[model samples]
Target chain A: MAVKDTRAEDEQLNRFWYRYKKHTLSRSIVLQLMVCAVTIGIILTLYPQPTIDAWIVIGLVTAIAIVSTIVATSIAMRPVKDLSSALVHISGEPTDLTPPNINDSYYSRNKLRPLLKQIYAIASANITDAEAPKSSIALPNISGQLNHTSTGIVMMNQSKQIIFANSAAPISIDSNGVRSLDLIFDVDQPIMEWLSERGEHDIHAEKSWRRIPNKLAGESERRIFDIHVSYDRGSEAETIITMLDRTGEYQPEDDDLDFIAFAAHELRGPITVIRGYLDTLNDELIGVYDGDQEELFQRLIISANRLSGYVNNILNASRFDRRHLKIHLAEQQLADIYDVIADDMRMRAEAQQRLLSVSFPPNLPTIAADSNSMSEVLGNLIDNAIKYSNDGGSIEVSATVNGDFVEVAVTDYGIGMPPNVIANLFHKFYRSHRSRETVAGTGIGLYITKAIVESTGGKISVKSVEGHGSTFTVSLPIYATVADKLTKEQANNTSLIQHSSSGWIKNHGAFRG
Target chain B: MPIKNILIVEDDRFIGEMYVRSLNKAGYSVDWMVDGNDGLIAARNKPYDLMLLDVMLPERRGGEILQILRGGAQDLIPGTKVVVLTNFDQTEQARKDMEQYADGYLIKAEITPKKLLAFIEKLAASS
Candidate 1:
């Protein structure tokens, strides 16, 4: 978008110059002719009578008037003429808009000086805006910081030329400011290309850390620099591209996720086999168990199964805490998810003597979500509602079509939380004072839920009123790949519950406490 | 039709034996290979119904082996449904690469033999 805006501005500047040039030439001719006509009329009025000698006097007067008019027009137009030539100079080498050598004449100093300065300011401002939208990032006194700091600092103009270079900048990149920074820094490869292509730079939006390989003096040893790029739209530095050497500290080879995964994978194999064998025993596929033995084995198997769930949650929570959870996104129809989850949740709600109400508006947009994560998120919220709610309290799960987002809210009319408790609900290992005593929880569910929600480019929020139930809303972005053309007719029916796949749509079942 | 056969490519002997026993009990003809190289060779030779590949192996990494199986580095068993099994905390890089080719992904310690059998049975029934 920025690049296209720049090209448009450049074309506009060029067209303005073309029109200005033609208008000046035509205006000059008209002015000269007017001057000659007025001078000739003045001579005729002064003579009053016509004779051969008088006619000669008139001819001389007209000749003198034409000569003086031509000279005066040239003199007056000279400054504008110089300015046009200067504009052409500035346009050709626009990236570096420094006014160069010019003829010092009577009109050059006073007229052209301020005008040239004003035009330069406007062109620079336009180009900077083209580089990046007026950045909301607050950058402090960069020049002062650069002088005191040891790290290399180089600020680039719109064309990627080093406009301001501290002494440390050249030493770090091992290149003088004589060449385009691309030769020394590798922003043109991945960082700049991704920004131009995708309009973002961060690996994640929270941190602006990007690794750009620094081309050392020789290709023998590879050196890397971790840089955080910030665009300063207003200040002298149009784009502050800060480089910090990360060759010593950042090592991809030493990442420990593989090791942890390996250990976890190793632990699962034994656990799976043991659980399978236990299931077989419990099923009586083995020799028939005696009454007392069967009871003991059942108890053992139940505990083991519960242990497995705990282990899985703990392992998953470790990743979520570190923000290392991996999720695969696809365009998934919400109807399929609702049908699957609601079927099981209905049974659970009925067992607890509570009512579970589910409603889905028709033509619901598909969300860009990992089905597994979606299942886990929905499962967590529903399970929490079931556990936290009082007996016979109703739980409502509804899917509403929000603009550019699909909101799946689970509102339970159970034991609602106070504001102080609700504030710490999403924090890891934060158990409410009321729920901690009554409910059994690890407090990792909401933390994992929040992480999964954010990674999908969405948000999860909660609203609660003390003595009433709490509402937990998970908002997911509509998958861009899917064609979800919401029609005017569909928009009229805010509750299109009767329209979507009816397997789980608008199901209302109440159970007696 | 012939029996549903599967190749279990895992380095851990304990895990390899456990999967073999469960797969056998589930009525699958299972071939267990302890090394990634041997697993790759076995997969190339036979049309196994499914392949359980572990990331870390003695001869080759599980990712590299899957790459060849999926026609990335080399195409060996393009039609074979592979399950990339790893134990560590999830990594975005591995999942993004392996999930493209694999039929399923599992963390072994987190999944029991019955769950593994359930996956195999589902894959077998679908195929």
Candidate 2:
């Protein structure tokens, strides 16, 4: 819609220029001719009357005036004729505006072709619009060239006021209104400026908008859109944005899902038989075997565990993509949850020669969070930190309580991220270029973490430098029920600060109750 | 340990038969059932040293069967050890269920027949 509107505006500006140029040139020519005529008339009036020589000079002047008038009239009418035909074409009645038998070779081809194409498209588009007032025309819209399409389209002014919005946009905004776009769309201020400046330069931004806060009556809605923006050529002032509903696009291909399900179903049998064989071998219940056979059995066990992990990751990602991921919430201490996840991941961290450390202050304020979800979030972050960090690098987890909010920071001394990637750190399937080479990441961990954190009334943010390291801070609202335990003064003064000295342990102690 | 009766409870028939063959080749008598209900009935009808149970089974679930076996009816068998074999690993629910019943839980893809036999042998000896 914006694209079409912008194109129309462009045409109007073009017509204004066309008319302005013709008028200015004609006016200047007429002024020059008038001045010449006045001078000639003055000369004739001043001279003695009725001599033959004087009559000859007068005839010569009159002949010159007649030739100049014809030239001026023809020159002026040429553009006027072009304008008339252009206007007629624009108003739904198409006519051949390109003059017949005009020698195109006379015009400079290189300089004029682009301008001519622009003029032609603009003129033709308007003609189609006027011709078919009710019929759909092939003109660019927000999506670029919409022909009977239903995509949510929105246009906002500088004031953030939604001026021209489509019905789909309103439906998507739902009860939350345009205010929701402001909350979720986290493009940089400079990017917005760039969009405005470039006008129609395509931008690839991954924007995640929460499904409208309030639901439509009785519609069990579990849908969200991840819009990918690209530029479409239209006008210079307004941008052209294209959105792809990623939820619809990212659902695993049916073949993959079926394969996984079938494999899992088939795996049960062989595994059962394997377990039985292992039991027989260990018991010497079966025929005696050598140490090599026992070692092979051990290898089989390890392979199986690894395969299980892969299958689980695939299944989890599928659930998350489907938006069927759910978290069970309960009142819990941040430090305690950290301890559990840390312990669970400690062996893995040690096996990789990386250090994991955690810290939290005593008497720290409690937050209402689901322990399982929190564990998953922490595990993912810690795992990523371990993966990206150097072999002997150190990782730290700390918590600080700020009134109603508690901030949990996970800092890793690793190969940090670039500014480009730090901005899109939480986007799904978004991986840093550097990390892509060495690390095997699904790129959905941080996205899942962000979703889990936000769904529980908590927010996660990242701070990083390319070479130094990265710190991910999660801010969660302190549990409301526990607020009454502290007086106004104590509540204001209560703050928890913890620092980890080494791997998975805080010098300030594990957690403050 | 040389010659004994074993019961295999699994939803997939192919897997159940494979277990039966492997255990039978090991010189131990083996009984197989496709569902938890039939497995439980088999356990009641005959005495068995160990039972290999699949976690997700039709008619009755492995967890339900574990509860019944661990309940007052355990006097009927005197001493029966069950090991839960399942594929859903790393999940909190699966972990919780593993901790709840069975001597030990083994993910289906992770354990081999020989290693499984070792674990069962250990369980039998310890009992």
Error of 2 at A320 (Å): 3.1
Model 1 chain B: ten consecutive residues of lowest lDDT: B118-127
- Residue-level lDDT tens digits of model 1 in A73-172: 6667656655665665545534332343434454365556667666556556655654553642213323443564445566766555566766445333
Restricted to chain B, the TM-score per model reads: 0.88, 0.82
Candidate 1 positional error at A141, Å? 16
Worst 10 residues of 2 chain A by lDDT: A497-506
List TM-score per model, in order: 0.47, 0.48
Cα lDDT over the full model 1: 0.62
Clash statistics: count for each candidate: 11, 22
Off by over 4 Å in 2: A1-152, A156-313, A477-513, B1-34, B39-55, B59-127
After superposition, the stretches of candidate 1 with alpha carbons farther than 4 Å from their true spots are: A1-271, A274-323, A338-365, A391-394, A433-442, A480-513, B1-3, B11-22, B34-47, B57-60, B67-74, B89-103, B109-127
Candidate 2 residue lDDT tens string, B1-127: 3327778887776566656666676677888888878988998888787778887788887877777777454455555666677764335564444444555555554345544565556555543
Name the lDDT value of residue A279 in candidate 1. Answer: 62
Error of 2 at A90 (Å): 4.9
**DockQ list for all candidates:** 0.21, 0.16
lDDT of 2 at A511: 21
